[model samples]
Target: MNRQHWLTAAVLGIALPAACLSACGQDRGGFKQIDQSFSPDASVDAPDCRHQCSLDGRSIVEACTGTVVETCPDHLACGGAKCIEPCAAAAEDRSSNGCDFYFQSPQLMKRLPPSCYAAFVVNTSNQPVELSLELAGEPVDVSKTMFLTKPGSATLLQHTGPIPVGESVIVFLSDASPEMPRNIEWELSYKACPAGVTPATFAQTLTGGTGVGSSFRLQTNAPVSLAAMYPFGGATSYVPTAGLILPVASWAKEHILVNGWEASESGSPGIQIVASEDETEVTILPKRDIQDGEGVKGGRAGRPAKYMLGKGQYLRIVQDEELTGSIITSTKPTTSFGGHSCGDVPATAATCDILAQQIPAFEHWGSEYVGVAYRPRLGNEHEAVPYRIVAARDGTMLEYDPEIPPGAPTMMNAGETVTFRQGTGDAFVVRTQDTEHPIYVAAYMTGSSGDGKTAKSYGGRGDPEFVNIVPAGQYLNAYSFYADPTFGETSLVVVRAKLRGEFRDVWLECAGNLTGWKPVGTRGEYEYLRVDLARNGRAGESFGESICQNGLQRMKSEGPFTATLWGWDYAASYAYPGGMAQRKLVEAPLGSVH
Candidate 1:
């Protein structure tokens, strides 16, 4: 691999200098405080602002700058994140971000690679799922599993494994009844260009009309969260991208797509929409002109085009043009995804891979986020990965801590996007001028060559994979995540913040201690660290059989944090955020979800 353009972080080992360590400062979450006595100046413009503790036991961080004038949500009073007011009390019904029901389906993604799907059902409810269920229900046999996250008791490591997927399936508790609404959450994983499949339908993507074409009708008695990982495998040109799967209750009428640039003969980049309710009407306003191919029609650039879809039906818009700024709105709640069928990161990267992520509605967007890269493309530690920030509202002014690469836009219009590379083995925080201006940020694993390895540090190790970076304010303290144990390697990146200038620790059930946290960037006093969870070269490889049952894990912390899961092999790899709080950081239409 080439090393000419990679950043310096000591190629062989990590070089965390003493000056990069935080000597003093409140280890609060992503919302950097002004010149408070507890921490150094987070902003030169607001050096005089400070935080005070109320006699009633609540924290109040006054805005130090004129630009910050937004009010906190009903549950929060001061500062911008859940970390500041550690002792504040408020009435919250946040049992867990799950719903009584959810609608889900599957996709083929690309034609070249044979695909297989797997799912991990998480018991987000406080009560244990003591019984076994099958079909669309959770396919977990509690006895062989590690054990679910228990309430008010010593933690027991649980590994329920991945549920097998087939046809259009429903995910609901067998015991669920209309009188008792239960919520559940699940993660979807796609094994790329796999070794083999017994039958062709094993990796089939739902095609054709309504009911028969529909996927999951997740009618639960409890709340549930949904997300997916689209991974492409083979000997080369394979990578993964993942995003939070928004439930129908949280869906909005409108959404904006974010993606990397790619216009090669090999793959095309574009947006896709899936209908939740029958007879859903969708309109697309493409950012660039699209060309026609296969049996699909093309939407003219700069013009609004409409399409009607039935429940479980999906639309794929593949083209040579970029779709980063495209806008899609529906008459009813719908699922929207964006990425390349198989393409390059910058149009010049030697190879290309599949990328697909379920996008959150515009209403779920946030202004504060922290973006970090994977360990260092397998072999190269100094490799600098790429990241992009997309604006949800016009006239958005972006601010970045520790500076940004030149040409990265500080001012952006709605549907506009800006790209910059992540610093060598580091993380960076980006926030809008205020809370009203929401944006979406994503991280991408650099693309590699045919050998599954590129020439330079920035070039290859794994292939191209991209994942949405859930903002800090939307981060949570608990997560039920799974890593595919079949890969040659599997690992996670855990990013946590401090509360009230005090240090906080997080625990991963599969692993001990959750230590060795290093500052994200040179600005250590900023109070953030990029910690590794699993970096071993191999993770007990499993073939096509029950993938998740072998790789499930649970993580917990005292305060909000973010975890990203990724795995790589010869030339195949996948990446996605483990979980997110995804709170109501921005305004949404009526009946939107967290």
Candidate 2:
């Protein structure tokens, strides 16, 4: 295979050994015990009542049908069963409420590479939203307003003109629906632009929405790109492509690491970066690389590109030859991608090639994330799907579920990554103690090629792909997205927290031919369901590429949840692109009563 194509397998983390595939379908076990102090309130905690109160009596209407809870106090409003104040009640807390939000990065001249442009996404609720732009604290008029009316939707806004590098710009979502909570979500990003022109194309997927702000310093955008190599530590080459990485603030700095292996595996893995043609001179630093003479060295023993990149120009470097993690610093901002040419995880009996991911610009990193490990093809559980967590700053802390006590990494430094060999479990939750500096998280499917010959199974097909975890803070109660018209084995993976109750109801409507849901398996306090779009309706008619117009599916639920879609053909599988949802803007504290 062409070396560049090898990166595709790495991008998905596929190519697991049969041992890995055999471990895919582990029991959906129970959750770890949570602190009672933080538990959500339900009528079960109310005063003596022989029977659950009916709304006709002192009952509060709940999310699921045939259910009732103790009535809320006079001041509290019924949100499912818990009595909570209206979202508008906390209107003054503009920073925390989802209804009204703002994005601002001070003069980048001092912190970011010069002449960097910005990118952002705005998630709107059922109602229309209005926003304003300001620079250096002065209002700037915006002429374009984009919308996606397929149920719940988000709009991506890329500033076409170069933002004054040294000046600050603020985009505020101020006008929200009065009848309903504002439910507006936004994220900011920056990328060093080429001196004389923009890169031919741009890439990133919208990954988060819903929820009030948890910290003013947190930056959250969807995972738009990822690249990996094959056979663990092999050296594969890639055709260089230009992209952007915007700094979060003037203080933005990052640690990049490229995993190293023995030189016998093709060659040593390495990383390369080019400066934009615009007279931008960046200082390149050589950090830790394999120290042994046979191992990859820092900057791979110095293969020179340039200390600075000019407009329309590029940079390239190699160490261990695979681009896992390597640091890049510039006098101004810069743009780039991360991945490998070929490699495999879990020593699998499948294809051993992968691609790279457009690294989510450091400016878009967040502290909380929710994700599901990729599953082996049906009948191929021997292939164990896995996931990894990479820290973006020093002293970054982490906590996750399906509890890993003896193995979890609580403290991480810049450029460091920890992989949890889950070999099992359907979903996971990772949260950071310091929101200001969040880490990067990714899920890789155990390797499998639908050809179905090796794992001793009838069901199997396609290569593997990586799924970017959406931040938990961005979880939404509603989602609308499209499935590729050409991909096969398309499906949706939905996960929800059960703190609110044993039953969290979700409604899904797709292709105008199906409108209902099937109960999913539960692992502790979490409930998850997988819907195979291809198998939902009359085979090959309502679904499976036949319903492109109807391919737009909408999901809404009584509680907040996150959903990601994956599609596979006879040879490869990928998380559907350009999907979006809305976060909760006005719900009360999980267990708080008015």
Candidate 3:
């Protein structure tokens, strides 16, 4: 998989020759004027630049040395031609020599197949630049130098192998970012690696304590069966990853993605798929035990029943009972991940072990959320950090921050669920007043700290983990994720929307080397900050230990923001919920299409 096209000579500047890259300048009616500072006989230079220009200087661009270049309508860089000005053209576009920002993806296996792609970059700029990579266009020898760290930190590189479909994946910023092209932002998250497996390519920056998520987690000590599909079927559904199944019948139903539960004798485990062409109709309701917000209603949840699953086949439920929240539906698209053969999540007494993640699909659910609850461990404030809040649509009307009125829940119809036990709050921001029908919150932590209460407190047994929240419409003035290096204690809660007076121009930049941050609580527009990232923790310690010690964080914002990351070590715990690496793994290659 490697066709390599990589183009963006600093925003397509010098690629030329498609007939001079489309007519090379001087089109008058279409505008292109330059010459107010005139006086450029200094031997010649500016005959290239291309974006806006018309203050009146009789257009005339032709310099491939054919010389004639004298333009600048209103777009500066044209009177001579060495060209500059391009942070996307206009906010006063600059760079006589600086600000650079590029984003290229050509196809990365478009529509799906050759698989295994990975490219994420988040330097949301404030300084510290130089970060290059280009595969089809050459240049990619490991080039580094990115410091200036703080706005949520980020850097996962992986990609020197599998890519097959026309191939192309460039990500540049090789030094530019006087806030150019908005500094930097990239994303690509391929999948499909089955035939012989082998993933992981080369460039590995991932960066200290990573934190953005497409819902990843399948750690291993032994048994493992985590497989997720979808090479190209997102952005609403193109559904064609490459056979085996996925025609989606006609798609009017069926979309459970992944909801396995059960922690002990091993229960809760289900994965469904089908659609090798037609007759889709896949289903699974098996309530098994259902109790974490019990038989959810409006969003429909009685469970203990229903069946189906045929078209192409793929279903495997694990031992005993308790298929924790299992649903699985299908009318069209399909992709699934198996669950707990070994278990552990919110059980906490000593260690219950094993948990996996990778379900998301309902088009990557989101409707505004923030999490950091389940507190405990640090002298154990009596324990509390359980969370579940499902409901993809149907009337969804949940809300919470400091007020957990009966624990907040006014509606919740489609797929219904609302559980929030364990309250020692310091961060929770549930939201759902419609925001175009989005609701799928998730947060749970319980591995040990058994002393917090009885059955061993926490989740009341031992071992439980699942985190999925970060949906302020996928907020992203900019971001980069991948933190969970596992040293433990890394906390960061940040949730923003507060706009009123603009909250003093809001701030939080993490990667170019930190910046103002302050906030511990504020409910209305939502605001909370609490950072720690573990360098060996200890700033005001209540429960701080080695959090984001540079496993990759790179955050960003001036107004809209989103974040969530917890990493406990009392016994075991790791959370994730920060989005926007192009809204959860690249779909909006450049547009804004979460």
Best by lDDT: 1
Q: List ranges where model 1 is wrong by over 4 Å.
A: 1-110, 128-215, 224-244, 290-297, 378-381, 450-460, 521-536, 539-550, 588-594
**TM-score on alpha carbons, each prediction:** 0.66, 0.47, 0.24
Top candidate by TM-score: 1
Supply the global lDDT for candidate 3: 0.35
- lDDT for each residue of candidate 3 in 1-594, tens digit (9 for 90 to 100): 000111211111000011111221222232211111211121112444432221111233442222345543333332223333322221121111112211111111111222223222322222223333333234454323111222223322334432222121222222211222221122122223223223322322321010111111111111111112222211111111110111111122334434434443222333323233234444555444422211221112443333233333333333334433345665554445433432334332434323444344444455556665533444364356656666655555555544443344656665555565544355555555433455566666655435354535433222345555555544433334434332235566665554223542333333232334444235345555555655333222222232235345545444456566555443344444544211221121111111
Distance from true location, Cα of 25 in model 1, Å: 22
lDDT by residue for model 2 (364-466), tens? 3556665554334564333455566666666665656555423446667765666554442344555665445566676655344322443322133544345
Error of 3 at 44 (Å): 41
Query: Which of the predicted structures, 1 or 2, would earn the higher TM-score when compared with the native?
Result: 1
lDDT of 2 at 114: 14
Q: For all candidates, what are the clash counts?
A: 30, 86, 93
The lDDT per prediction is 0.49, 0.35, 0.35
Query: Ten consecutive residues with minimal summed lDDT in candidate 2?
Result: 207-216
